[model samples]
Target chain A: MTDPDRVNALDERAAQWALRVDAATLNPQDQAELDAWLAADPRHAGAFARAMAANAYFDRAVALGVDRDIPEVATGIPEVSAEAPRVSERRVMSRRLWLGGAAGAMAASLLVALGLDRLAGSTSLTADKGTVRRTALEDGSAVTLNAGTEVSVAMKPLERRISMLAGEANFDVAKDASRPFIVEAGPVRIRVVGTSFLVHLSELGEVAVIVREGRVEVQAKGTAPALLTAGDRMTVPAQGAITREQLSVGEVDRLGLWQRGEMDLTGLTLGDAARQYARYSDRRIVIDDPQVAGLKVAGVFSTSDPKGFAQAAALAHGLRLTERDDAVVLSRK
Target chain B: MSFSRERAVWLGRNVFPHEAALRQWLSARTASAGLEVDDVVQETYAILASIERVDHIRNARTYMFEVAKSVVLQSLRRARIVTIDVQANAQFLEIPEDAPTPERVAADRQELSQVSAAIAALPDRCREVFTMRKIQGLSQRQVAEALGIAESTVEKHMVKALAILTNAIGRGGNVRNASSSVREQRDDSETSDRSRPRERA
Candidate 1:
């Protein structure tokens, strides 16, 4: 998306077409159109040139206005309608033909109206580095604990309880009078009829419960029952059920990204983040030097490839690595 | 299909040495010489392991070369070293007394630079497809499955990239073939290479 084309689309074309162009993420076809427009006429080109020249490059407000409404322009897809189910040239040009004309509109309408939002729902249990997760329960209640995810499943009863085992699983209860949703871990019971809480468990020996939704009483291997609520979180240590302040939103998001096969680090050292990313990956990343280990990296990066990320750090900061038999050592390049 | 566990093992087995060797080869060719084999091997392993569906790579050797090729070219470009002869040295330095004006030549040069930059700026995925087709030589369908994109998308990126390049070249007036004499090296048995319409890179 060149400066001239962006201007031409923004100023000369209807606001609708501009929106579709932006949403396509710089697709080549869209790029071609912009090029053709720039090449075709001096006036069309100038109208774009003048509009861009006169305006400040899209202020945040105007940008937001454009961003928010851009999805709608895609609906002008003169293609087949849901009501008719016909695939003719008028309503159903191939992806190529449609790209030049009504395709953007058609794509936008369907994508905005359904696709983007729908894609978000089907995925379950995304995990991230060093962050926890919590969601509002349906009955004006909530569930909280360790899955750092951005944009998660819309909750329902049986559908709500996630099914998979990754690093850790946490559950906060919302007291429903009808159904009692108990988290199923072999023999360890953290029963919740309707309350607040947290449970953190991974593929390791580490398993703990933090209660933030309501009073979640714990029972396992002669461990005593503990009550927790909205303002509390417990770290199931090698010993006691330690509780802390109400889990913050950021911390919650960090825990959920893991399910998405990522690590959610806002501001953590390379070593700390590496340890979290170590779960999904088989190869181990060793922060050999304490000084280099102390280097803080921050972002919502994936954990699926720990070794890959270490390489990124090496390239970015010249942090070299010494490949050991079982571990990767990070040092000054 | 879920080669997550196997992906790491494959890295350590097939990819590690090959990539380490490429880096060694490149470093051998580079100003930064005498890098530790162990260290470069470690770094190369880490880089390869970073990608998604890396486990889907059946031929670790070819995959390593692909990644190595990208890394090497990028490093070479960054260091302003010519890995290949994209910029032919005008072949000779003979000067015509009535050669074109510097301004006219510069404008043409400026336009060419823009086109080159645009092509260079293409993302890893798009560039890989374009290079294989235009530079290294491959068919659209071959480029498609190799890069794991649709055939149509391969064409789309190709046509778009070509359109941009052609437009840019038209302005520049550098009428030379972009990658003359460059042939796509295919180790067909060594690699599950896609078919390509041959052209010089």
Candidate 2:
């Protein structure tokens, strides 16, 4: 076995090389030396690859706005009360984190037998902009609600019924073959015995479903049910045949990133991405030109900061951003 | 000999075994040119392998980079896209007979998830500092200012974060057989600290 110190030294060197490569003002001489160091050994090359990959990972995560989720204090330091208002803010944040888990165990006790004895009472959940919530169900399963989404769950002895009133939600159904879990979203109805899947219901009746694990069967009125396994993404337009496509692991991973307040726009039009941002921010993003709306964009962005998104769009596409009191407008420079 | 075998032999014997550095070089250039790095690498490999007199090459590594640069230029010219510098073409002697090949684009997709996971595993303060500097693309001073910490503290956090990440990722894979060789650096002063599970914000 190789010495651990030697490995740490290699990793340290590799990390330095990665940082240098990404440095804003890297000279050619530095590049030449980095290349030389890499060429020196296969091990060096491997370590450097890991380092670079880590860098790219952070690049993507930053774009996705994943970094904004962390609290200011994080874990390394003591929770100091130097700032008066921020101390209160931290308390609220910590309280939110504490309460952030399942709306609570009290949810089960809130069940009244007013409904049919065979049927468990229903619970409705709604998540506003920038608020993602995970709530446990009576049957040991759980549902994670995305921002701007509303879901109502009613479990009967024979069937588990979930109605997506608006927006999107992911369901992790407990295994109960006797009681099939059914999610009704607009024109589509998804049935599963036990599986985790996401259902996105648009106001226009367009529905999209992505299965994380196990199998789910999706159906429309009078149409044959389509079987979607893990990593399957099926999009049903307001009025058209349902389209099914296989999603790469990266693509599927993106689907659940919203739990961390990440907005994954792997392939979205500027208009669509703006709408996604609107779901999180009170300040709306408005594209002044039709051409700007059609511009394709892909990256992760913070949902809570529409101005940041506008600024990024402006910098990236050479567009002009005019921030109004109510909205931020994007147009050609 | 097959082109791949010959090229592999040449790479093993001649070039500085630094695949990571080569890829890094290609990635930076390609990102600016709005081209995929893998495609450029593939093109460069084809040109280098097809050379009739590989034995006559002096600096194999520099020659490969030069050929790679030429491939990008040739591609830009053929496509009628002048995104790169105009003086670039004057620097190359021969443009290989190659067309842009249709290939899958998500070659390094796994790396994103791996890195994200590793970031999630980092200590809270370190993760925050590192994410601000790397992900947010903030300068060290900017990160220090934003967090109300000293610049030196930010740098220390960055170093700690980088060391942790490289150790984790390097051991996991991509630095082949690095698992047996690597160990997580212990910060004796910080080991007493308790880490909270990642909170969903």
Name the best candidate (by lDDT).
Answer: 2
Write out fnat for all predictions, comma-separated: 0.00, 0.08
Q: Residue A135 in candidate 1 has what lDDT?
A: 37
Identify the leading candidate in terms of DockQ.
2
Q: Residue B41 error for model 1, in Å?
A: 32
Task: Report the alpha-carbon TM-score of model 2 versus the true structure.
Answer: 0.44
For each candidate in turn, give its C-alpha RMSD to the true structure in angstroms. 21.0, 22.0
lDDT, candidate 2, A1-333, per-residue tens: 532223245555666676666554458797777757754432344445445545554454456555434445454465222111111111111111111111211122212211122225787878876666667677766777888899888988898899999998988788899999999998789999887788888888889999877899999777898999988999999887778899865466566656535565646888998888877766889986889999876554445456655665665576888978888999997
Model 2 lDDT tens row, B43-162: 344334333346534344545555555455433332333433452233232222222211221123454454556566566677787878876679988999998998767765675577
TM-score for each predicted model, relative to the true structure: 0.32, 0.44
Q: Interface RMSD (C-alpha) of each candidate?
A: 22.4, 23.0
> Candidate 1 regions off by >4 Å?
A1-57, A60-167, A170-179, A184-188, A193-198, A202-232, A236-238, A321-329, B1-201
lDDT of 1 by residue, A18-130 (tens): 22232234477876776576434222332222122111112111222222221211222332111211211211001111011111112111111111112223345454543
